[model samples]
Target: MRGTHPSRRLGAGLLTAGLISLGLLPVPAQAAADTNLALGRAATAGGANGGYPASNVTDGSQQSYWEGPLGSFPQWVQVDLGTQVDL
Candidate 1:
């Protein structure tokens, strides 16, 4: 579980430490939080090729496909998230 629940997290941490101290549980390795900030976010492209729009990338329709403007070198694609997010 995530650490969002403080009371439960504190209890778990205390229990884990106690167990490790008593040699009942081994110390765990560190790991990064697996959070996907881009899920469901909008995408905007500099241009579109025919009917392929940038929105196709995140439209929730896995079958949809996107193609940036043809022959446009180094096109600009941006994610228009409504709020600031930590990468």
Candidate 2:
């Protein structure tokens, strides 16, 4: 049987270290966890006088967004994640 070249072994080691440092290696417990809690969730704004509904925020489209009425002070938009999050 042939042994792996010294340069090849060093390259493989470096690649493994890089992946571990970047968190690409999966953890056993977290591999199956849901990381994003706000995907496709409902969103609502205080007002949509210009036809920009609050749901636009979660439609996964860059062209659309929730726009508050012009000249309105203290505008606000809210999203419901369906569960409490740490942030």
Best by lDDT: 2
The collision pairs in model 2 are none
lDDT of 1 by residue, 1-87 (tens): 645788888999999889988979865532233554555788888898999888777675768877888899887767767888775
**TM-score per candidate, chains pooled:** 0.47, 0.52
Residue 52 lDDT in candidate 1: 86
Cα lDDT of candidate 2 equals 0.79
Cα displacement (angstroms), candidate 2, residue 76, comes to: 0.5
Candidate 2, position 29, lDDT: 49
Residue-pair clashes per prediction, in order, are 0, 0
Per TM-score, the best of the predicted structures is: 2
Write down the RMSD of all candidates, one decimal each: 13.1, 9.4
